[model samples]
Target: MLAGDGKPKHILEVNGLRKTFGGLTAVENLDLRLEYGELRCIIGPNGCGKTTLFNLITGNLKPTAGRVIFEGREITAWPVPEISRLGIYRKFQVPSVFEGLTVYENMRIPYFARMKPSILGRSSVSRNEHQEIMELLERVNLAGQAGELAGNLAHGQKQWLEIGMVLASRPRLMLLDEPTAGMTIAETKITADLVQEISESSNISVMVIEHDLGFVKEVARKITVMYKGSIFREGTYEEIQADKDIHDIYLGRHR
Candidate 1:
């Protein structure tokens, strides 16, 4: 897709991305791009560098060589907070909600995290901000639990709460690492629909790293397969499932 000015419509572009830990290379010479509001899923065997790739893009780790461009600007090596401010948010494999706080209280933290130093207190929040938090909770199906402690939520509910908190920050892109991990089969299906709803209803580009083939098939419109520290293939779910090379990789015929 292109913009009115004829530029590429990609919301993020990663060119020649590489990361190495001393003699071990985790990621090597990778190229990726995502257009605005695209939902892309990545699947690979363990240690194939999926999480490492996410860390590089989110600034948790610096790339040995690469460029991360977001919204048409280079953001490689930017600090985590700065990158987040640029509208990129990452939801890790583990849920990171505020366990001691209520669902409503947890939503307030992201808002405060983005506040300018001059206005960084509870008094700075307006009534509209409170309503916004409630609305965000409602989007995640947590409206009735707004007063409940976050720690007491079911595993799936906690995951949804974290997603809602990320949405509160108004990210342009969201990297979700196995959002359905540890959920029951029913919960996994619900999460898949939730993610699809989020992507279609919001303006955020989404990238998910998931190992569950069933879940991936349910949620991913496009899938990128990684092997031996690089992207091995990219295609639709049917294409990937039928590819002999993918079968070989999974069967341990190819390393």
Candidate 2:
């Protein structure tokens, strides 16, 4: 839906979203809107419902209440594959690449999945598809290692490879859960750069859940702080960092 300014409205919207596991509430009454092509970072302490929110949006878990709207369509409770086909893709905290396959081979999986070739016969990539995969690998900085086994890549490289694989699906919204969980300072910075570049260069909207404050500061255009299953604060990095209450809650100084 276009707003008054004639610009596209939120690419993804979560309204009064809630989730519970028996007696425990994981996410509650959370409302979020991600603008088209925006890069937003979500930060909070452990057990703050960060991953649960992702699960709900990606259809890994059905919400106990509320709705998930993507590009003006309500997708709440849709199956995982159905949501993925609707241009919403997510990367979990762990790198889920195909370790047995070469990097190039891993890239081919999503590309072909999107192509949906005939089920009656085997399919092969045409010249244009091959070029597209190579271009995607280049974007993820994995062109040089395309022939290497995915298992042979370093930790950060594996993460990048998984990201590239997600990108191969041509998603409109990318949910990254701790894309830099285990990375050196340098790799984290590179990841920040890559994410920023992707958001700026493409129409994809990125929502990242991260614990690394430094990484968050580097990449977040806007920050959402989650606490005890709800949004505690939303602002620029500096504004969030300056709020003493946010710090206290994040550090467990005041439970």
Candidate 3:
């Protein structure tokens, strides 16, 4: 679908998405849309198929039904590597960094991944490439720790490093699964700010699935509430907060 000016209406569209394992349905006839550069949050109770949805979208697992459209093209059953090369990337709840490698070395992995020829065959990092690596480290507040082993970093720092690693790939759309999980309150707030900055400054669209209500309230401009494997409600933060049905199912009076 196109806008009035003829641009694509949404960068992503999931039509009637469904996923089942044996007798259980993880996701059920779900429909979702995301505009270019938009940030959306998905929230639901445990076992509500949040991770399953991410898996299906990223082609880590095949959908039982429906189509996933990206930039106006259908990519319902694309392979994982193909989907990733098309500028769709996902970061899981756990940090997937190379623990024994230095933070700089970890960043080098994805940076080289996007290049035509493998940099692994090269002897040393180019001057320009080194500058780019340092810049990404700075963005994640890890410039000072570039030489430190990733395994030595704190929990929150590891998460940030993983995010920086993904940023190196220069993805157009990012799927973050519980980015702030296991983070302290202060770290969560910092993550919220970083996510907002990434979207505004880099113009990358982001879809996040998080269980942290406080973090969601801080980062989400629009929130999608999922229930029983489908989108139950979608609106601005205030609208979602004021929704009685949402309150009853997910957010209690404490919210």
Candidate 4:
């Protein structure tokens, strides 16, 4: 739907999106479309507007101009909560949750949404919710610490909890940024498996922004390469890794 104005749309669409800040351009005339349940990755060098693009998508920052359509609705400039309520949940690079709350307590929190209200969500979900939560925890290998305080958990556990919190809301699209930051190789592999399970287990679309080529290649089905606030190229993981221009761009030869 188009906010208050009722309408349906393709899962997600960004047509000619543009964002400019005074002297600097963050995202310029960008066009992006997401199919239902597709796992898409976004990669770029520093200052290439990756986060800015995310901000625009999550309503953290408004684009200078563009049309943002989600599930057949217009949310180009919608606020965070509104966008979230519309089933587009987002996760940050850093973990977010009630540190003081135990894992059980954290999962017991209330649910918030404008549509499809399930009195029991991830925290306090019933059989289905509980099953999903348990599966997610186990999938990420965090079941052993389900009763521990969210703060008492390890760094990787904390990250998993934040992901669990987002799961509690049952979002249709997940925006993940550097989910494996500071993690070891084994941990990163585990997390990647969990992400894969999530994709295989549901119809949720994932738009991941990550820097590690190996990591992205592990989970990404398609990759969108960004530079200078616009898309440099989009292709398969192998295509991006072997791209001549990408190498030049990384070698400081592309301007």
Per-residue lDDT, model 1, residue 205, is 91
Q: What is the lDDT of residue 215 in candidate 4?
A: 80
Candidate 3 residue lDDT tens string, 101-145: 999999999866766775457758889889988998999999999
| Regions of model 1 farther than 4 Å from truth | 1-7, 123-125
Collision pairs in model 1:
none
If scored against the real structure, what TM-score would every candidate get? Answer: 0.94, 0.95, 0.95, 0.87
Candidate 2 lDDT tens digits, 22-89: 99999999999999888999999999899999999999999999999998889999999999999899
For model 4, residues 165-191, the per-residue Cα lDDT tens digits are 777677899988878887887777777
Best-matching candidate per lDDT? 2
Task: Return the clash pairs for model 4, or none.
Answer: 8-72, 9-72, 107-123
Over 4 Å off, model 4? 1-9, 110-132
Please say which candidate is ahead in lDDT: 1 or 4.
1
Error of 4 at 110 (Å): 5.8
The superposed Cα distance between candidate 4 and the true structure at residue 120, in angstroms, equals: 11
* Model with the higher lDDT, candidate 2 or 3: 2
Model 2 lowest lDDT segment of ten = 114-123
Q: Which segments of model 3 are wrong by more than 4 Å?
A: 117-119, 251-255
The runs of at least 3 residues in candidate 2 whose Cα sits more than 4 Å from the true structure, single-residue gaps closed, are 5-8, 117-123
Candidate 1 residue-wise lDDT, 1-255, digit = tens: 468997767998999999999999999999998988899999988888999999999999999998999888899999998999898998988999989999988999888888888888555557989889988888888999999999999999999998998899898899999888888898888888888998999888999998888888998599999997789999999999999999888777884
TM-score ranking from best candidate downward: 2, 3, 1, 4
